[model samples]
Target: MSSTRVGRGGRAAMVAAALVVAAGCSDGTPTGSGTSVPTSAPTAGGSVPGGAGAVKLTVDSTVATGIEVPWGLAFLPDSTALVAERDSGKIKRVSGGQVSEVGTVDGVESSSEGGLLGLAVDPGYPGKPYIYAYYSGGDDNRIARITYRDGKLSEQQVILEGIPAAAIHNGGRLRFGPDGFLYAGTGDGSDRPTSQDDNSLGGKILRITTDGKAAPGNPDGRVWISKGHRNVQGLAFDGDQLYAAEFGQNTWDELNAITPGTNYGWPAAEGISQLDGMTDPIAQWRTADASPSGIAFAKGHVFMASLRGERLWAIPVAGGKRTGEPQAFFTNQYGRLRTVEAAPDGSLWLTTSNTDGRGDSRDGDDRILHVTLGS
Candidate 1:
């Protein structure tokens, strides 16, 4: 790592070069994230918080027949679910207890860690009729658009190209902010210093328009939004607050509040810090416990998917600070947890990642787990 890192754009070429040497491998089934219903609704078994003490887990393997190395997931406006399988490059739709292959994406660069990674519905483009995707293509991270209507893909449009890619730090999570802008987390691709450089898109959380260009009113007139990140895979917004789960180099993974143009200190700092000009992390855990991936806000808590820790974390966020200790569930049951979302009905939807050439998975290992916390 350089003492003073080069700008983000300048070092992206290094990422492209690194991925070429390693190729071949990999791999969410988001089961929920719905609208507001009153808490008094009736359940078939009565409302239970679904915690370890209150309830037990029931994993479903019937739907696993169609998902091959599942990666990311999204929900349609009509309430149908779309899931991406990284190795298969196929997108599957689930509705009324049936999972169908809607379509397949081409040109996915399936290296050790590069492939179709993130899928997010356009919050503002809901009326425009397209879903967005983030994946590695030919060893570079890219964002594209697919017309996903009536549970099928009709048109495919490559929106933006030339994001840095490597076996690590591709920053593959995508989500829409409360402001209706697309936010993406990119990894430093082993060059940790690039995270602090603004000119490149790697190692940063990018705020972009629907067209994959940087949103207007940005502090710098480029795709770089917030610099100094290693491999941020989890993103969520609470009311108006922005939060992210970031993977650290060799130390602690972090939970942070996303602020525009503020550096979070990548090579110089791993977790929280008192150093000037370096943003501090709100919460942190050892890398062995949490190589945290997707995160979402639900039922007054922040839900996270852990890849290394093999658990789902329920963190409470309030007033831009962590309220208390997080509750851990599904520990080592499914292998590696990757994504989580709080559905409109209050159930926390979770996705798994053990099949992504990592984790010690059991039979029916990498599967989505739906928990009904209130009963």
Candidate 2:
């Protein structure tokens, strides 16, 4: 287990690299970011060969099975992982290759796309020992803080609420950023206008303290870090650069580089646009190919999970920008893929969403798959 440190100066380099990649000029080559793709023996699943300077990857193993709609995953300091089930509201622990329900989140209204969606452990866990979650409550979406001790979850408290919720567009993905603040992805609650409204909490990425208040240095001292999103379901940080996986309507699905106070045109712009004062997505996919969900960054690339597409996409990140075309893995082999999370062991943990009333569920219906990057 090696330690990976992405410093601020490195972030500037990544941004510069991303700008070059965005300009559509730089060749798809890694810039020695201290992380290298592994060259290992072929595993059970076939390997996907990398393009020039791209990281090669393969499916490692299926770690846990029989999970019903596992939506969120967060690794503990001890390398144990917690998985959240959307429809059941159960928080399951994965340790020693076994999955066991530790607790269920109360008052979660599981409707369509809404449910217990995202989970994050306190950065100072054991000392803090709190598990944070984003879920759909009775009337809206909310964040909760729960205590974890002796392998049990207790002392649940709703720390934040008031974001609009919808059966289909309840954005729910929680993560603790490099700056130690909690950030949340939210949807427009099916009202496109809310994405453009600065006062609305929906359709935006929110930066807040662990206690759920506005984070320090937030624009205008508010929870909004950026605005104008349709339904942002995934948020990841590479060094200091933030990237969001957004669900676009009808036309496109987007991967956007997040900048604070920036407006990503939502209803006004679905995919590519030259609209003034609005930020455009660096990468866009047709709706059928990428109904993107949870995303994770590893090995100089961003891995996005797709529900409708039924695959995992690896988008190369060089210098800080996305380069070349994305490669798809496990296309329709594991039903609907919902989440891709980086693990402590440098592998990726992926959850299948077959039981989410959409996919072709098998005997296990849903399961967690482990992926290893290889050369």
Candidate 3:
């Protein structure tokens, strides 16, 4: 194995009013940063936060269906997206509400939670015509680069490998940062000790170039930007600040404001421990209320997709800090939400994880949905 290092909204006015009242900030002002709320306070479909209150989601259409555990969703220069299947190792193209097979990633070994997980189109696409993937191989998890052209995939060039792999906690989510470098999230692989181990790549946020070497200016010339995470599957950027959603043990799930060279308390602190030298999540939820996987920033809010909680959470952010309480939407409406991505057309594309052996699969159990702001 090789090691590298680096480093929404809206709503009807009346409904928004109700939420502002419920939040006790009817004046439409934001609350404090790192605010923690009870999972029981804002029930599903409650008042949206002030920042997200003006925008409401309306499912416009189903873009694709019959996908076998679509885990990674990345958009091309043409606005069409490439979707990766976790279990099948296949990459599908979704455009104009039609789905077509692009290509399958080789050597993908699916287990409890590991498989082909994250996808990212080269920031300079068309010119680069390359796609990056994070997948679980037979012995370890790897990040590979593949060329796409004429609907075919060239042999994968493994850029990074040797991340620990386990049945449950192989963290896989990839995105090209605003800095033009690639970022990856890894889990502890159920080995709690690794979360705090600086030498281990597991349970760390890695920053690297497309070639998989540590990005320039990374702390200690290592690929890790931050460490001490359980299982991180959700990563989104609001301008320059990066936010991550991670799965917790039994007590809490976290939405942290990721900073380089920082240590996020994992095995030691589940939620708001206020421990010195450790960064706490800006917001957190009960484990049962939010096993958040994918998150996107749109409409002045961070939209988080919940798997175990079967809900979508909207957390209002202003100037890179949480301004209002996190609000839950469409609770149990879309079972096991996996990914939420903001589209070029100012809409959002969401995927369901019903067919992932966890949720109850409907006829169109696993599908990509097109959602837009409601009037």
Candidate 4:
């Protein structure tokens, strides 16, 4: 596969072909290095000839620093960002470049990749005044609704529990869909059978009401909207179509176009399997190039944060399908990115994960970067 880079004066510069095979590995350690790509500034918004030519990524500023493995990022109505730290179980508030610990989530147990993993502010916001969190509890991974008012978080109520938990691959990423229901991604928790078992919550994309009941009209009235997943970490919607970023076992990492009642072949297959009764990914990369985590849709593209790959990927989409080849940015410049969220101001907030005991920690081991998009 070939990679494209935006060069001087917004020209599409073709880079060398991607190495055919990357060493097999999970998201633990990087197996290969990335080619350093130069960035060019171009005006954002209007569509260019090719989708990839429509936008460019550039870091605008550093939002916060010295933060530990920040995983989930959600914006309040006031544009304040609540960052969930994976190891500390603390929810920090970032406003105008100041980061402050608002409160610690109770009963959170930090393990390998567990802890406070993902957060979603109530879509109703001030009216609902609740923040939803998915974390590793005593014996299982659970979701809790906490009250956030006047700059403090209080009154945590566990709304859902009992998704299998493990030191690694405890999938945790939360977001409210366009329908205003909470959608959660869970891993197989090292149990491969669970990925194909609808009776189990592990390895599935779950849709439920804010109160934790299965959302109405789900397949068989169960909370599961889809099954057969390995470790899903990124969920975003382009209009009504949902896309997911998943960590593969060894060979391929996936970017899936999600649909209700669809089965994504996980234990059976990694990337593109044309087998019957399974859906293939819209895009895939070698695990070494993309241990992708959180993704956000902005500037006519889906921006994905890669951990082992140590880069940000911009995949152009039209009508929820890939319109062109994916492009990489900031390769090896920032180490092990974990999350990316689109801000209200049309910019993006990206988080690093070097301090997660995975990558080499830098001066500010883990930090949030503000990014602006251009043509």
The candidate maximizing lDDT is 4
Please provide, for model 4 over 1-375, each residue's C-alpha lDDT reduced to its tens digit, 9 standing for 90 to 100: 121111111101100100111123445753533322222212222232246457766787899998988999999999989999998899999999889999999989987678999999999989999999999874678888999999899988888887866666678999999999999999876666778977778789999888887999899998789999988999998878888999887767889999899999988988888879999988888777788899998766888899988888888886768887777777788899999999999899999999998889999768999888767
Q: After superposition, how far is residue 283 of candidate 1 from its true place, in Å?
A: 0.4
Q: After superposition, how far is residue 205 of candidate 2 from its true place, in Å?
A: 0.2
- In model 3, where do residues sit more than 4 Å from their true spots? 1-47, 51-53
TM-score of each model, paired residue for residue: 0.83, 0.86, 0.88, 0.89
- Model 1 scores worst on lDDT over the 10 consecutive residues at 24-33
Residue 5 Cα positional deviation in candidate 1, in Å, after optimal superposition: 21
lDDT of 2 by residue, 151-181 (tens): 9999888878877776666789999999999
| Cα error of candidate 3 at position 316, Å | 0.6
Worst 10 residues of 3 by lDDT: 23-32
Off by over 4 Å in 1: 1-66, 124-126
Model 4 residue 229 lDDT score: 95
Name the weakest run of 10 consecutive residues (lDDT summed) in model 4.
10-19
Models ranked on TM-score: 4, 3, 2, 1
Q: Model 4, residue 65: displacement in angstroms?
A: 0.6
Against the unseen true structure, what C-alpha lDDT does each candidate score?
A: 0.69, 0.79, 0.80, 0.81
Mind giving the per-residue lDDT tens digits that candidate 3 earns over 67-177?
A: 889999999888999999999999999878778998889889997577999999998887888999999885678999999988788867888887876666778999889
Local lDDT at 345 for model 1:
53
